[model samples]
Target: MAQSYATDLLHLIQGPPGTGKTLMLAHLAQLLAQDGLRVFVTALTHRAIHNALNKIPQVDANLPVCKIGEERLTGDLNVPNFETFDQSHFAEKSGGDVVGATPFALQSQRLANVEFDVVLFDEVSQITLPLAIMGMLAGSKYIFIGDENQLPPVTTFSETEAAQTSIFAYLAGRGQETMLNITYRLNDVLTDWPSRTFYKGELKASDEAASRRLNLSPEATRWDFVLDPDSPAVFLDLCHTNTTVRSRIEAEVVSELVLSLLMRDVAPQEIGVVVPYRAQSRLIRSLLRRILMDDEVNKKLVVDTVERMQGQEREVILVSFATASQKFAAQMADFLFQPQRLNVAVTRPRSKLILVGSHHMLKADEIVPEHKETMDMLRDLDRQLPDHHPAQRGYQRVKATRKQIANYYRLLISIMLK
Candidate 1:
């Protein structure tokens, strides 16, 4: 990896999700610094840039790194960007080991004289070609780290203003890219459908043996939140509503399952709630708040749209696919049809994944022909239902173990009596 600097003028690292791209970036920066080269690491957003910077050790300890742009949302790191800092403050450490910033920050007049030996771009697919070109001008050589299959640059408004392909995508087509082969996030069972459907069966799990089967813990294996202990990926076939109001049934079921996990000694922070739309996230959050009164529990229970859940992971993930009804399928299809969105949602769970939505909507040809991959993946999950689970053609059972069953009814009875 360190030899990338001497190998090519422009190198592309095309890695799939959970392929340790960020960790690779950090190590590359360290190697470049060790070789006495000036390096700059960048991404499109402040959060992304900050994340890359956070991977490096303290500047004083090893590399002298500066972060530029808006203050980080978390304020976890106090390092200011070159453009934000006083000219003299940056000048002191200006020629130091490495720097992290957004492309816009690199264009600043303050950094015009600050040349870099190598520029590393994280999430390069999110960067447009023009911005990438401008950033490249500051360095003699460059490296791009991104997964085009996961999410492409957001260029809805600049359809005609800018070319659709990212710089990474453009270079990759010419065969100037290296693929990161190992994936640390998913086991083989969870990765099978995505591999064949998205990457044409090219994606490989880091653990060949573990990838061969779903490795649920003893508690999770017996946890009947859904049927089939061997199935890490599941589809909970709920009725999708056409109204603007959220699906109450989905919300109730999510609540019950989340509570069940909590009752079973699962940490709240290890669980996540993924929904297709912002409206559904809001409704689910509200429902969770009412049931989980503790602020800590509410804070740890992440209920958000899939876009927001990207670059994040949890031990357990519950996805809410609220798109149902033929009339609403058009609107819902707009949000759910994209293969990238589904990829992001499905891959975020490390241990277990549960998808809740109407199976009819998932398999409907009338919804959107372009979304066949998304539909196919959903159907593959639905096919995992065993005969013993028992449901209609389109409806799959959400199973729970004996203990969960006992606690569920016990809680229900207590509430009724109260």
Candidate 2:
């Protein structure tokens, strides 16, 4: 159970990987519904908001959910009072009702004009400031939830010193109060090392701190782990398997080993092997088929990318990252170390993470290099955003601005970065 705290009308809830931010929002809505308060739950993506609002039906079967917009969505899963901005011309169908949309979508004369009691923003860091502010304007009480440590906004200004954790900190300074020291994503055993590495600078490291940050029991255990039956474990893993295109002998051996694992009873969904590049995903898929044909092992196995597995979990996950290009490897290295994104991939597994396929690819020089040029670039762009962002900046502009910048600078940042 969560220890309750006092929150102002405007609430900002932030926790690490495993803290139940989504569930908290749902329960809060349920409580308000009990009081006969009409609650408007919203967020950056209409699809994501639909996921949240649809939870209403399971609780209250009669609650109507209507999707209005370009997505051409409507029906039972749609929140009756909800609307998506970028979807088909369902705005006419809305008939004066407020709907969910990206910040830029809501900036129009129509969507932004609606009113409501509570507006919620999830994955708040992914969007930009202008939209956050605009969304805040659409509702009386705005609730923003995010995990800054997992992934900062992918923007040119991302290297800005404030990009990592102060996302909600900025809002708190601007009258958007925060719900501090709560987490839903990670448990103790899993978050301990990262907590010591990532957050130890400002605060002392302990299970309490880890629990609060990760939102799990101190005794909680993690399932994902990378091991070479013949080698030591790698902590920050971007494991990949190759089926055809291979230059090095080690890469070949790794591919063979991955094939060997699939021959076992592990269901295709039980193990997720992700290679960031399309060439890699394709090569592995093709090779997997060929290997099954030639080998005596049972031919049951599966492979896919991280984006395809969002909001889904497995029993085991083996993520493969190829770093043939030194620069590409460096980018992959950053993706692996990024606490926010790292959380997303690792937490997808309920049992174990067998990170195979990258000892030669992501050598020290191949990953997050300490180059003066890049650091200088990061420091320069860091100042573009407000230290104290506007309280109501919607996720659209903030996230969009970040994406635009990230793409300009980190063109090679793809797969997981995308």
Candidate 3:
């Protein structure tokens, strides 16, 4: 479909998490450039622009690709910047066949007179209509690629106005977009719920990815219940409560998990900790710094919010939902249980995903009426578990006690082994 290009055509590709949208964009850009059409690529952020262009060389090594922006903006990607070319060269229409930039960078004087045969926009769901129009003016044909279920454009406008102004939200389910059906990052076990709840069960895992497991050795057996290689998705039920944004108990548990992974010889770079609140993230990082004490190791592990984890993957991802108080959770229900935020946080792991939180808090019946739909969706995950699963029984037995949680973990390991 990408090979057959025409003028004034607008195509949308809806790619869910881990579905390789950036790779498809790279191939499309290379193919158009080979056919003598100037291709321009832009996204909402510099990291996204770099991610799309970095894959072009893998498709075809000789394609002349140029990235627009300063060196500080584009990280570690080996692509030529617009500043390398003289103003007269671009004015003569003799610049690189493919150029990449953000919508803001597309407005620079250097590319003011430049135009392209095709313009591809990545992460369009996070882009508003006005920003999209800025890039649309630079080309005659267009291809928009993103997942509306991941993250919507951050805006101060009302939800109604935001939806009307978002191109992806407006045109997503109206039968105009092509859906990528296969994900290579998540195993089948980890892919099940999000696929059913968000993608209408259209997404499936590749055979190799479906069978993939964490390659932990016997030395890691201490954490086998939480990091079970056989089970790709594990939820540690820490039935504790936190009335505020920061939970010291959750931070301590996260640090212990990181230390355990490191002791088992997992590369620090292969582990990531994603939290919903910045205060929680800061608390976890501080605990890790004091425990690990090595600046190099500390820098290698990524500890950040869900927004920063988009377009990046790790072998193992630990999600910390720090608020377990019913009142506090209800107050922030819209942000905490937003489908897009939950989806992005869970789908970031390539091998294992560990979700640590109080299921009871999220399962409360008194949640705000507007967020009840999302709360029910989470409840469905618990309902689907086998009657004998630890998450089902542990919630009642642990009673917010650490010792009981540890006892519950031992029982879970026995069942898993049998």
Clashes of each: 9, 52, 0
The residue-by-residue lDDT of candidate 1 on 12-50, one tens digit each, is 888787788888888888878877788888877766777
Which prediction has more favorable TM-score, 1 or 2?
Answer: 1
Specify the highest-lDDT model's number: 3
Q: Tens digit of lDDT per residue, candidate 2, span 215-282? A: 11222111211222211112332233232223232223334445434444444545455544456666
True-structure lDDT of candidate 2: 0.45
* Alpha-carbon runs more than 4 Å astray in model 3: 1-8, 83-96, 158-164, 363-367, 383-401, 404-418
Residue pairs with clashing backbones, model 3: none
Q: Local error of candidate 2 at 242, Å?
A: 13
Stretches off by above 4 angstroms in model 1 are 58-61, 72-90, 93-96, 109-112, 157-163, 208-223, 227-229, 243-245, 367-374, 384-418
In Å, residue 147's CA in model 3 sits off its true spot by 0.6
Candidate 3 C-alpha error for residue 117, in Å: 1.1
Which scores greater on lDDT, model 1 or model 3?
Answer: 3
Question: Positional deviation of 292 in candidate 3, in angstroms?
Answer: 1.4
**Arrange candidates by TM-score, highest first: which order?**
3, 1, 2
Error in Å for residue 169 of model 2: 5.0
